[model samples]
Target: MRFLSPDFNFWIWLQHLDTPDNNLNIPFEFTEANMRQVKEILSHYPSNYKQSAVIALLDLAQQQHGGWLPVAAMNKIAQILGVPNIRVYEVATFYSMFNRQKVGKYHFLVCGTTPCMLRGARDIEQALLEHLKVKRNEVTKDALFSVGEMECMGCCVNAPMIAVADYTKGAEGFTYNYYEDLTPKRVVEIVEMLRRGETPPVGPQDSSRIRSGPSGGNTTLLSDPKPPPFRDLASC
Candidate 1:
């Protein structure tokens, strides 16, 4: 709840949108097998309240769409679930994870959060812009890349992390690639590899031992557990 800050008037706004005569009855352009898979996703829930399956359905649709969710695909979801199309749109827009516009072969998402910024994510972002000739919210001319600045992506240890969502690399090799301890040079190299239709392994493609360990590395994980639940409560 703390992270979900969506406007509450979405339903009201939907009713007012001038719908195309065929809008309400539109169907998803999915394959018969995919449709079956979607229905099965719903079978896990109890009964008619299909809205409960919206998340999984949308996610499946997104994967079907190669990481981005299309408006019509969203509409299809609404129709299949018997919910308002606007409702699906509402869900799509509220989640940053869903991409509305078509993303590049690789969605170059740079984290601009505190730790990343401190670690040089800005440098990496600037490098991406300069090297790829694109800016935040803009896709490359070649359509091979798109730049996006997002919040903490849980790579604080490897601050300056970027999640590559190369739509070209369909469902297998890597769903997501996190680049950590990035530099302008490193970022450029990664993009160049991507532009050439290659997935240059996940982290710093260079020879640096940045994430390796605190021999000054990029990988840092907490060593000690904070203690089981209230195990230390008595000490308080």
Candidate 2:
């Protein structure tokens, strides 16, 4: 549920650092203005307790740099928040939703949680490892896909979910995005497309077989229309 931490003063320092201006250690996409905006978002909370903004700030950095967080970016976030760099790393590492290493342009994290497992997530994981021709915790040759198994994604009703596309490009092509409600074939197709640098639609896949409710049918009941009656207010 959580994503990033926030910082203010340190971010400014990071911007003014001797190193050439950069974004996520990639090229510069997030400008100083962007960091200021992130700071504004963090300012809503006390500066000492600014870690609350970690999730949001991570998201902000990811968005700024095309979707992944580099060590530099994390350090900047740490400095801005006035917290130790390790604190930011701890948060980034603690959440399954955050990415420490490089990932594919469309990172696919298969959920192996109980609810997801009950719905056949193992096949999903195998499918990714096999389809992408990459092992768990390894990046593909194209640098466009890293498939790993993850914990619950909090969508039990959907079951068998995947977290995809947390990032766009870094050491890995993309990192930190999550996708849910999928089948092995569906995930494979999406990854293949991403390998070609294409975007795939997200959310509950367009499959009639998925069904709805117990019977896989609509539940709205129909009723007959009644005749309208006109009421006339006469003398009191």
* Top candidate when judged by TM-score against the true structure: 1
lDDT of 2 by residue, 1-236 (tens): 11111343224322333333333555323577776788698879987788888877876776666545667878878877888888887887677566555556566777877877877787888888898787675567876677655677777667778877545544244444445567788878877777676767665664553543322554564466576986665843
lDDT of each: 0.70, 0.66
lDDT of 1 at 98: 72
Best by lDDT: 1
| Positional deviation of residue 184's Cα in model 2 after best superposition, in angstroms | 2.8
Stretch of 10 with least lDDT, candidate 2:
1-10
TM agreement with the true structure for every prediction: 0.73, 0.64
| Tens-digit lDDT string for candidate 1 (77-194) | 8888888988887787777777765567688888878888888877888888788776565567877788776789987776678988766755343377888777788788888887
**Cα RMSD (Å) per model?**
8.5, 11.4
Instruction: Give the Cα error of residue 33 in candidate 2, in Å.
Output: 3.2
| CA lDDT, candidate 1, residue 127 | 85
| C-alpha lDDT (0 to 100) for residue 121 of candidate 1 | 77
C-alpha displacement of 197 in model 1, angstroms?
3.0
